[model samples]
Target: MRSIQRLVTLGAAAAAVVVLGACSAPSQEPSSATDVPPVPTVAAAGPTTPAVPGSTTAAEVFGPGCASLPTGDDPGSLSSMRLQPVAAAVETNPELTTLNDLIGRANLAGPLNAAPELTVFAPTNDAFAKLPAEQRAALEADPARLATVLEYHVSGTRASAEELRAAGTSTELAGGQVRIGGTGDAMTVSDASGGTANVVCGNVPTGNATVFLIDTVLVPQA
Candidate 1:
């Protein structure tokens, strides 16, 4: 009986060892998880400004002659000129009297006022007055010839001083072209005949056009 009891106790001990082994997990090294790459960061862009169209560049009105123009509601003033069409605006400025008369003689007043957009390289009264009397009278006598000459001073599209510089050349309504050279007050407009003119007043806005008062009259190519 003592031998049988000892055998039974040994069997229980063996069973307990098996149960403990089964309940506990086997010793194992921790798993090394995959190393995920970090997401890339992006930066935002800055805002872009739009370019102005034609003479509407609205950049600024400047030039030596700008100082002489009247201020406020006077039609000749830059502010007031902006309110009138090209032809009507021309009538208000004393300096533009000769130009206005030439426009009438050329039968261009109607066309000028009707234009949707334009850039006029207008000669000051002195420019016209400086011409030989005979030549001026001859030009005035022939309206058709005067029209061509007047149209030569006009560009189909409006351009500011900087715009003219950027383009290097401008096409005229008369089918001719002018070469632009220099910057600001030094800027020069050279015709096909080699005649060059300097802009006195620039960025003078009309309801439908921009005018640059030049010191010399430009002629188209023959």
Candidate 2:
């Protein structure tokens, strides 16, 4: 009877070891496909947006004459041109030689240099050349009259392309009104005598003021 009991106890111990071994073993069953998490998708980059229509940019203010402007490295360039005052800046441009001569003769260069925030509508040499010889001589002979004519070309306030367009008319130091018309490359300025000048080069910034090189000399009414 005792021998039979020992055999039964040994069989029970063997069955418990098998159960423990199965429990301790790693899982062999395959995982479900849904058990893994999905990865997030990345978005592709897009192109830049363009500028708004009808808006005036800095390039627009420079006008078409900028095509003839010297590069920054050139001594004659507008970038180098700004290093000096307006009077000195004008002297650097070969095209404005006549204007420079007139400014010096009239003794207006000193005053122009001293003036703050002035907008000068400088006429090219061709403009002065277009004037009748007798009239030109008479004006040149009289410094006071020449000064008046020169002052008529200047405004106390600095006028940009957009400002001139918005104003339509600007009051000058000569106590006369200058009519500003058109937009962009077609912009024109009219003096008291109804003579109009095309802005060849607009918005040339200097140390003291902005300069617009016009194609015609502006004459104030007597």
Instruction: Judging by TM-score against the true structure, name the best candidate.
Output: 1
User: For candidate 2, lDDT tens digit of each residue in 1-222?
Assistant: 222233335546877899999999997553786676566888886754213222222344465666676776565467766666788888888778999999889877766775545678889888899999999999999988888888889876676777888989888877789999977677899999989999988877776667888889999998
Quote the positional error of residue 92 for candidate 2 in Å.
0.6
* lDDT winner: 1
Model 2 error, position 191 (Å) = 0.7
TM-score of each: 0.74, 0.71
lDDT of 1 by residue, 146-219 (tens): 88888888886778778898999999877779999878677788998999998888878788788888889998
RMSD of each: 32.8, 31.9
Kindly report which residue pairs in candidate 1 clash with one another: none
| Cα error, candidate 1, residue 124 (Å) | 0.3
> Candidate 2: misplaced stretches above 4 Å?
1-61
Return the TM-score for candidate 2, rounded to 2 decimals: 0.71
Candidate 1, superposed: residue stretches over 4 Å from native:
1-52, 56-59
Residue pairs whose backbone atoms clash in candidate 2: none
